[model samples]
Target: MQELKAALERQALAEGFAKMRVTRPDAIPEAMGRLRAFLAEGQHGQMDWMAERAHWRGDPAALWPEARAVVMLAETYTPEADPRAATLLHDRGAISVYAQGKDYHDLVKRRLKRLGRWLIEEARGRGSAAEIKVFVDTAPVMEKPLAQAAGLGWQGKHTNLLARDLGNWFFLGAIFTTLELPPDAPETSHCGRCTACLDACPTQAFPAPYQLDARRCISYLTIEHRGPVAPELRGLLGNRIYGCDDCLAACPWNKFAATARDIGYAARQGSPPLAELAALDDTAFRARFAGSPIKRIGRDRMVRNVLYAIGNSDDPTLAPAARARLADPDPAVAEAARWALARLGIAIVDNPDMPEP
Candidate 1:
């Protein structure tokens, strides 16, 4: 078992994973209870899918009873530049580091498939049958807790997995298998008396240490919540058009984070001008964000987020971009355009002033 574990670790490292560790299927028994509490408190926001697959998400063993071991791998996407620097560029749209390049879901899944196939071939040589399944961020599986259980990292005060070595700039991939691999020691919290992440939150999304209210989270508001954003939170979003990284960037542990090995996660063309992004029509938006995770949001939703940033930008120069979208067919985009125009104090002569409903 020890020899097999060593071999698996080597294979994972060769496959471009930063860290790999194994845990039993039932290692995270407490996660389900915490998940239920979080759901009952209505903290998941518009992601109702969290409630729909509560059972499978809460218990990975339930997702696949045949799986005896869960291998959790971390792939770093740490930004070359300080992610917080983008926030200060109020006239530019700050895209989260994770979405700056090709979609990680596609990148990580391809690696997992390669590793899974290798594991199966390895097991066959040893006269053992190995059945496996791989999942990236899209699955209902509770990745953070599972990663912690595998001795990868602890869920930090910000609720993101942070390691003594790797920090919080990685994506997690899981390989569940019938082969009973030796489990590693679970990681314990290293965050002692540190509120840096909580204090750094622009929206105060953390209700308490180790708990996150996603409804108040800027990342959720920008990416998940459809239609016009709640007017109150729009100002707090700053220039972050796609996702927020305040908490992740604030972690002191990030000083030890390794540079991302995958060049695919590198920031593209720097941060694009907010005025330019706001000017994108559906076709232009699709082309610009091709192969990017940002493409999934589509033009209407992306434009709505851009309008919110333009409103908070304090640069009246972006008013023209906002005005162009005032007559957008999508009510949400038009509403956001109106809000931006109002904040910029630019009144359009042809458009009647409509108060925010």
Candidate 2:
């Protein structure tokens, strides 16, 4: 089992994974209690799916009773340049580093499938039967806790997994197997007395250390939340049109982080001009974000988010782009346009009844 574990680690590294570790399916026993508490408090906001699959998400053992080991893998998608600099360029849209290029779900899942196949062949050669299932972020799997159990990294104060070596710039992938692979020593929390991530949240999403309120998170507001964002939080969004990376960028551990090795994770055009992104119609938006994770939000939601950024930009030059979206078919888009015009102090002559910001 130890020999197979060593070989699996080598296979994972060769397959472009930054790090890989193993843990028993029942390793994260405390996670179930925390999950229930989070759900009860309605901290997940509009992400009701978290509550729906509570049993599976909290307990991996229950998720797959046959699975003896959970292999957690980390794939680094660290940005080449400082993501915080994008916020200063108010005329441009600040996209999260993770969504700046190719969709990680596609990239990570493909690598996981390849690794699983290799593991299956290796097990067969050893006269052992292996049945494996691979998962990226799509499943109800509690990857962060599982990763910590597998010694990948500890959940930082920001509630993101960060290590002494890898920082918080990696995406997690998991492989549940029937093989009872030897587990690694669990990683202990190294984020002692660090309040950087909490203090850096634009929306003050962290209610306490290691606790996140998704409703106030810019990432959730921009990506997951459908329809209009709450007026109170719109101004705080700044130039962030997609997911925000303020907490991740503020991590001191990131000083040790390395730039992504995969070309697919590289920034496409740095920060795209906010005016140009705002001007994109459905067809144009689809073409621009093809193969990118941002495409999942669809044109209306993307445009809506862009309008909010334009409102907060204080760049009067972008008012024209926001004005063009005033008559958008989606009510949310039109509402966002009105809000932007109001913020820019641009009088809406056509829509006399447009409300104040």
Candidate 3:
């Protein structure tokens, strides 16, 4: 079993995983309690799926009755540029680091399954009957808490897992194995007296040091909210179209982190000038965001987010672009376009083609 654990670590690193740890599945009791409290308080807002499958999500043992050990993995996908710097350049929309390129759910899962295959083979060679199941964020598994318990990292004050080596920039994944590998010592919290993450939020999404009110989060509003944004939060969203990274960028631990080697995660064209983004029609938007996570939000939601950014723009020249979207088929987009025109001091007519402002 010791030789098998050592072999798995080598295979994991070769597969581009930055860190790996094995731990007993029972180490997440505290995290289960915290997650239950978060759901009970209605912090998840309209994301009811988090509460819908509470039985499986609240306990890892319940998720897979046969699993005895969990192999938690971390993949480093740090953005090339500072995710915060673009936010200060209000002329450009700020896309979160995680969405910079290919969707991580696809990227991480492919590699995890490969690792799982090797684990199964190694166990069978030892005449052991072992089952392996892999998961990314899409599963009922609580990845951050599982990573912490596996000793890959600690859950920071922002409620995201952070490692001294990988920083807070990496994406998390996990594999449950029936091989019963030796468990590693859990990582302890290092976020002492540091309120950098909580204070850095433009929308004050963090209700406290470790608690997040997802309803107030710009990331949730732009990506998950299905309708018109709350009017008060529109202006505060600034040029952040997809998601916000203020909490992650503010962490001091990132100084030790290295930039990602995977060019697949680099920033692409849809992260464009806010004015130009307002010009995209449904067809153009689909073509532009092909293979990108932004496409999942669809044209209406993307344009709705662009309109909010346009409204925050102090440039009057952007008014023409804003006015052009007033007749958008999506009511949320049309309403947001009207709101942007008002911000630019432009008068709106029923027709969007009523000459340039």
What TM-score would each prediction reach against the true structure?
0.97, 0.97, 0.95
Candidate 3 structure quality by residue, lDDT tens digits, 259-325: 6766778777535898778888889988988888888899889888988888887777788888878
Residue 280's lDDT in candidate 3: 84
Per-residue lDDT tens digits for candidate 2, residues 1-357, read 889989999999999999999999999999999999998999898998999999999999999999999999999988876799999988988999999889999999999999999999999999889999999999999999999999999999899999888889999999999999999989999888989999999999999999999999999999999999999999999989899999998998988885677789988847889888888888999999999999999998988998999999888889999999887878898899999989999998776544433
> By summed lDDT, which 10 consecutive residues of candidate 1 come out lowest?
348-357
- What TM-score would candidate 2 get against the native? 0.97
TM-score between model 3 and native: 0.95
After superposition, the stretches of candidate 2 with alpha carbons farther than 4 Å from their true spots are: 350-357
Scored by lDDT, model 1 comes in at: 0.92
Worst 10 residues of 2 by lDDT: 348-357
Name the regions of candidate 3 deviating beyond 4 angstroms: 350-357
